[model samples]
Target: MFEPVIAPSGTLLGLLQRGRGDGTLHALAAPRAAALTALNQCVLHDPRHDWQVENRSLYYARLFLDLGGGLEDIEAHLFGPGDDPDADETRTGLALSVLGHLASYGRDDALALLRGYAATGANWAWALDELALRDDDAGLRSLAGAVLGRFPATREGDAALAAAVRDAFEPRPWRLWAEDRRVSVGGRVRAARESGSFDRWQRQMRPTGPRPDWSVQSVFDWAQRGADGGSALHVPAARCLGAVAGPDDRPLIVETARSGPDGARCAALHYLAEAGDPAVLDLVETAVADSSRTVADAAVAAFERMCGEAAVDRARGWVHRPDALGASAAGVLACRGGGQDEELVLGALRETVRADGPDAPLLWALADGAGRLGIGCAAPVLRHIYRETSSSQLRGRTARALAATDPSFATGFAVECLWDCEETTREVAALHAETRDARVAERLRRLAADPAEEAEVQTAVRSRIVPQSPPF
Candidate 1:
């Protein structure tokens, strides 16, 4: 997938594309033509950084409903000339999702569109999955022939059908087909189901990696071999070590942590760190300074996993170092440190943003630390990161930080955050956004009523609007 061109933080389209709550407020206030145009752009293009996790379908669907928008743009986009339905699902997943939400909102046209697409669209499975949640039995049943016909009466086709049945995100439609009265439909589906079951069982029975009875040396060797093959099997190999390694095997483990092959070294560090070996911190610090970037990264990650008091003490001492270990140390402290370590965390946050800019990977931990520590002075920095950072996940973390630190959050970013592309951010907005703003109350009501809204978000909305009974 290509990186989407995000609009400047100032524009209404940018705000809507960013999934900001203020975007919704602004769009509602703007001319309906302008609002629908912007909403259509988002629905057709999909502005989310991570479509699978971030939410825009419900937000856009609600906007379409409010605008009384027709489905022509979406329909044309889905069935447009040269559009490959069988290509990557990213192209049409957002549009299909939006239609799903619209259908849930009682849009018969949207329902019809989904039914039509499921019968012939390239990404028919995704459309079928969406319909499985909302479409009636008759609507689903009618499409069985078209869907089943996609697979031919051959071994390869039957195998593909079994894979599809096995991997389906929603099984209601397949289950329904399995019970169909038609021999062609029900029989084929049943055979596919059986094949899928056997496939799963065969997979379970297949031997993979070292077994529990494998020697520690053998496990490390397996890890080394996997590493040689360009696979990072050390993570699971470390788990195998836990099962296989005994008291006398500490020497071998430590040897690997000190200077083993890249894969074995990585696995050993992970094992020792998770085992909470007292000497693991120093070993990690040493590994972080190693010449190999892979070893250094593994070391840093292993160190961060160390949540003991000793690890915090080590972080305090190493926070001043200007290297990957220093950054990881600060992150460890930020995540696991207490109020006493606030200054260290703050120093790291400012320095990281200064050196690496808002998009720095380290800022995620530092931002969360700022929030957990209630560093009121860090709100400005958090807000800057929130606006300038292209990462929605990072922006969500920044929103959480601002909520804890920014006193004006209830009316400021919190309101805009209600429409944030990330559900967690919207949940934050629902929990904290002041209802005094006219839009907040209405948004909450719409959220409460929208069948497509996330349950957590709606639950948060209900908590705000539904009055609590007085204590006895």
Candidate 2:
């Protein structure tokens, strides 16, 4: 592996071995503020980069934490308010692996420190995710709500923390619809109908200024004040029991949904449902009472998105409305509220999942459904897109839907995509296949002999198909 750029200092290691965490931490060997600054190094993508193969991504993560600068702080500096997203994405990917570990087994303060970063870190891509995975729902929602009310006072939501929220909120609309459908009993049919996008869901987005990564960001605020049952149904029950803050609370979602924008109410309902708290039923009913048809439709969508096996009978009440059947089917699929309502979801979709249809948004919903339902039955239709679809974009998306549902097929197609180097197919093909696969060698070697290969193709071929591991 290439030598570590920020290797743990020798004396530093010796000191830690002698048992020094708090002392060294407070001493500011790497200032918490300094560590919070971003780190993105530029390398020639040459033999030096090969170092990662030897130790895997070990170059960027653990030792960095051991050095005590803290990954969260580093993420903030790199992606925070004044940072560059594309320029810093590579470094953040390395940092992300580091942050994941910190969340799971780092010091109590280490987790808190990361949480603080999640709160305040620049929107460098993974900031929000790190927040979510670490269970900071309030922070996540706060960030979401704030962003919607007003973008950070910068061009393109420049604040790193804000950017992070936007990244998650940005809809791969088709992907979402398709995923929704993929995981549903209705499969592609639902996607072929009324699924929506970030535009539709935007009414629900609100983002605030970033907070300390160490701050608890609100993942499960429901089981609080010393409540601890650990039941399988705890989160669901908490939500149903009205875990959502009422109108008196800051940014009252129910009120926002009722009187806010077009789909605001749906987003509110959706967020509540995902809270994994069944206690939210009163809130849902209250929302329905206060809602416009648009909002009511959205609230129903929330039920599909969040409520699962725990709230079956109540969820069934939603499917009875054929006009709102799409959202209801999605709700049931999301949490399996009424067991596997595959027929119900599919019944909703049968009218929509047509080829060459205008329902692109719904296609993403379909994909999401298929993924949730875990149905291998839809593979044929997906495989059909792979073989016969004329629109490359749709074809690729369909393939994505398939892969999301069955990762094995995604991996398989990715290898073949590498060889599809015709002008029309090159980037899409390259996108699916990574450069480091074992078979890449043979593929590149084959390309190396092609006199008709484009210059770009030949460069790619020769750069990778090493007869031997080209020494640094």
Candidate 3:
């Protein structure tokens, strides 16, 4: 995936790109033309740090509804000149998802667009899946010819059709087509279904990876093979070691962790750390000092996995150091340290933001730790991260941390958070956002009635609303 170009956090585009709640508030307050332009930019070129994980479709769709926006930009983006539907789904998946949400909200234009795309789009499977969730049987039945026509009657075509049936995310449309007498697809669909089931069975029957009888050396060899192939297998190989190694194998395991080949050393370190070997801490410290980044990263990861008091004690001693191990020790304290370690966690939170800015990967764990520890003083830092970070997932976590520590959350971020991209963030808003504001109450009512909202978010909304108000 290409690295997304995130605008400055102060701009409306940046706020929207980050999926911050304030983006919706600002967009609504801005001139309609500018807002629509920014909104179109976001929907047309997804700004999510990881589109597969971060949520923006529903948020953008809701904005469209509020703005009374048209689907012209979306249509142009989906079916524009030079656009390749057969290309990576990432290119068009976000737009399709936005359209799907819009359809759920009873947008006839959105539904029509989806029906058109599924029949001819290269990413027809994705569009079909969207229709499966929202379209009627008639709407789905109309697409069988176009969808099935993708495969010819040749043997290779049949094989491709079977694979499509087997890998489909939604079988509703396919099943309906297979059962409908009016549609001529019944015979072919039934054959494809049977072939797909057989393909699944054949794949499951094929055995791969380490068996229960694997020896420690065998596990090491497997890890080495994965390393040579550029895949990391040390974590699983370490688990395999746990199953196979005996009391007599301690010395060899220790030696492997100390001076073996890279793959074996990493695996041995993970195994020893998980086993809580008394000498594992020193070995981890030594491995951290190693020159190879892979070995050092593995060593730090192994150290962080440790949950014993011994690990905590070592963390306190190492937390002040400036190396990666020190950063990891701070994280350990943030995750597993006691009340006394609160200051260290806060300091680490600040230092990380100051040193690497809010988008640092380490902030995710540290942000959770801040909330878990109830560090009230960390509120300012948490708020900064919530606003400036381009990652929606991280912003959601930071919002949680803020709710736990910031007293103004109920009146501040919580109100805007009701419109945040991530459902979990919105859920937090529903639970804590003060209902004193008319906007909060209206949003609560709307969310409670919206069929597209998550069940958890709806439940949270209902909890905040009066029970006597039937059907929201």
Best by lDDT: 3
Best by TM-score: 3
How high is the CA lDDT of each candidate model?
0.88, 0.42, 0.91
lDDT of each residue in 34-145, candidate 1, tens digit only: 8889888888888877786677888788778878999999889888774685467888999999899899989999999999888878888989999999999988999999
Q: Against the true structure, what is each candidate's TM-score?
A: 0.93, 0.31, 0.95
lDDT of 2: 0.42
In the range 1-472, model 2's lDDT, one tens digit per residue, is 2333332223332222211121133223555443323222211111122223222122223334445543445445444664443353444444454455555544454455455544445443354455455544443443433233333433453343233333454333222333433233123313322323343366558555221222111322232211233222223323433544443543465454345444333444555577655555555655555535545554555555554455566655555454454355444553453326655554443434463342344444554455456556666555544443323334445555565555566356555544431322333334444556766555556556644345665665565544667799
Stretch of 10 with least lDDT, candidate 3: 207-216
User: Taking the tens digit of each residue's C-alpha lDDT, what string does model 3 give over 1-472?
Assistant: 5678999989999988888888999999999999999998999888987887899999999999999999998898888763685466877889999999999999999999999999988788999999999999999999999999999988999999999998999999999889967534888888899999998898789856544337878888888877778888899889989989999999999999999888889999999999999999999999988988889999999998999999999999998889999999988988898889999999999999999998998899899999999999999999999888999999999999999999999999999999999999999999999999999999999999898899999999999998675685
Compare candidates 1 and 2 on lDDT and give the better one. 1
**Regions of candidate 3 where Cα sits further than 4 Å from its true position:** 182-184, 209-213, 467-472
Lowest lDDT 10-residue stretch of candidate 2: 38-47
List RMSD in Å for every model shown. 2.7, 24.0, 2.3
TM-score of decoy 1: 0.93
**Quick one: RMSD of model 2?**
24.0
Tell me the lDDT of model 1 at 13: 80
